[model samples]
Target: MRLVAPQFQPRTVSAFAIAVFLALTAFANPAGATSPSQTPPRASVMTVATQDRVDTRISGLHTRLQITAAQEELWQKVARVMRDNAGTMDSLRQARASNVNSMSAVDDLKSYGQIADAHADGIRKLTPAFQALYDSMSDVQKKNADLIFQTDHRHSAKKG
Candidate 1:
C-alpha cells in the first residue's frame, strides 16, 4: 500500500487517528517469542529496530499526499505522533527484552498491559489533531485518506 501525504486528503486528517492506527498495526505484528536457547539482542539494537520502519512509513505517507504549505503543520503533528508511538513501543520492547530472563508470569502480563496502555494513550493524543486535520480536508482528499488508512489497517490485520 502507498502512503499519501496530508495535502492529498483535504476532507479529513486526524493525527490522533493515524497514531492510534499505527500503534494498532505495530501491535498486530506477532512479536513471536525467541527460542528458549536463543539469546536476545542487546538493548541498543532492540530499541533501534522499529525506528526505520516507522520513519519509512511516515515518510512515504507524507510524500504521497503531496502536502501543501498550509498542511505542513498538521502533517508534522501526525508525524510526531507516529514517531512518538514508535519510540514508546521501542522502550516497552527494550524493557521487556532486558527483563524477560527474570520476569515472572505475572510480570509478563503486567508488561503486556503497560504496552497496551501506552498505545491507548498515544491514540488519545493523536485523535484531536487528526480530527482537526480531517475536518479541513476536501471530499476527494477524504476518500484518498480513507483508502490509505483502510489499506494499511487491512494489511496489518492480515499480517497479524
Candidate 2:
C-alpha cells in the first residue's frame, strides 16, 4: 500500500502553493494603485487565501517528508523573503481597503507592479523548495503534489 499521512491532504499543498504563486504575482507589482484605503481589503483577502493554501498543502501530504538540512536552510530563506514581502503585501491590502469598489488606472498600474515584484520575491524564495520537496518524494507522492494547489481564484481575481 502507498504510505500516506492520515492528516495529509495533497489538495492542500497544491492549492496553497498555487495561491501563493498567484498572489505573489498579483500583489508584487509596483504600479498597483489605490487611494490608501482599499489596499487592506485586497491584502486581507490575499492573506487569507495564502494561509488557506498553506494549510491545505501541509494537511494534504501523505508521505512523511524528511526535512533535510538543506530544506531547513531553504525554509529560512523563504521565511526571510516572506518577511520582506509582508510590508508590500500589507501596503497593497491597505491600498485596496482605501480604494475598494473603485479602481483607478494610473495608481493601480503602480500598485500592480509593486505587488508583482513582492510576489515574485516570495515565489523565488519558496518555489524551489516545493520542487525540492517534489524531488524527494516517490512517484505517487509527486503525482498528488500537483493535484492540490490549483484554483479558479487566479482568473477571477485579476490585478487592477
Candidate 3:
C-alpha cells in the first residue's frame, strides 16, 4: 500500500519552496567568506515567472532593507534572480515527486546530482545581482543584509 499522497497542491509546493529558501539562506554561507570570483552572466537572461511563494520572500527582503526609490532597480534585479532560482527548484521538486518511486538507485543519484547542479547554477546566477545590490546598499542596509545571509550555528552541539 502507498503511504504517501499522489499529487501536491500549489500551496504545498509554495511551502516547500519557502522551506528550501530558508535553508539555503541559513546555510549557504560560512563565516562571511568571499563570494566566487566569477560573476553570473548578464541579469537579463535569468528571469523567470515570479511565483507568489518566492514573491513573499522578495517582499520580506524589501521591507527589511528599507530599499530607497533609487535602489529599487538593483533590488528588482536581485529579486528576479531569486524568483528564477525558486521557480527552478520548485519545478525540480515537483518532477521528483512522481518519478522518485520508479527511479533506480543509480538513476536516483543522478537525478539528485542534477538537482544539486541546478541549485548551484541558480546560486551562480543569483550572486552577481545580489552583489550589485549590496554595493548600492546603505550602511544600515548592509548590516541587515549581512545578518540575513549569515548563519550562526554555535549552539547546535559541538563535535570535538
The numbered model that scores best in lDDT is: 1
lDDT of 2: 0.49
TM-scores for all candidates: the values are 0.72, 0.45, 0.64
Better by TM-score, candidate 3 or 2: 3
lDDT of 3 by residue, 1-160 (tens): 8456354343444322433346343322221111122122332332233255467667877897788999999989987777666655555554555466566666665665655666667767776787798889888888876655432221111210
TM-score result, candidate 3: 0.64
Q: Provide the lowest-lDDT 10-residue window in model 2.
A: 36-45
Q: Which numbered prediction scores highest in TM-score against the true structure?
A: 1
Write down the RMSD of all candidates, one decimal each: 9.7, 12.0, 12.6
* Pairs of residues clashing in candidate 3: none
Give the poorly placed runs of model 2, Cα more than 4 Å off: 1-19, 22-88, 95-104, 150-160
Cα distance off (Å), candidate 3, residue 27: 14
Question: Which prediction has more favorable lDDT, 1 or 3?
Answer: 1
Model 3 scores a C-alpha lDDT of: 0.55
lDDT score of model 1? 0.61
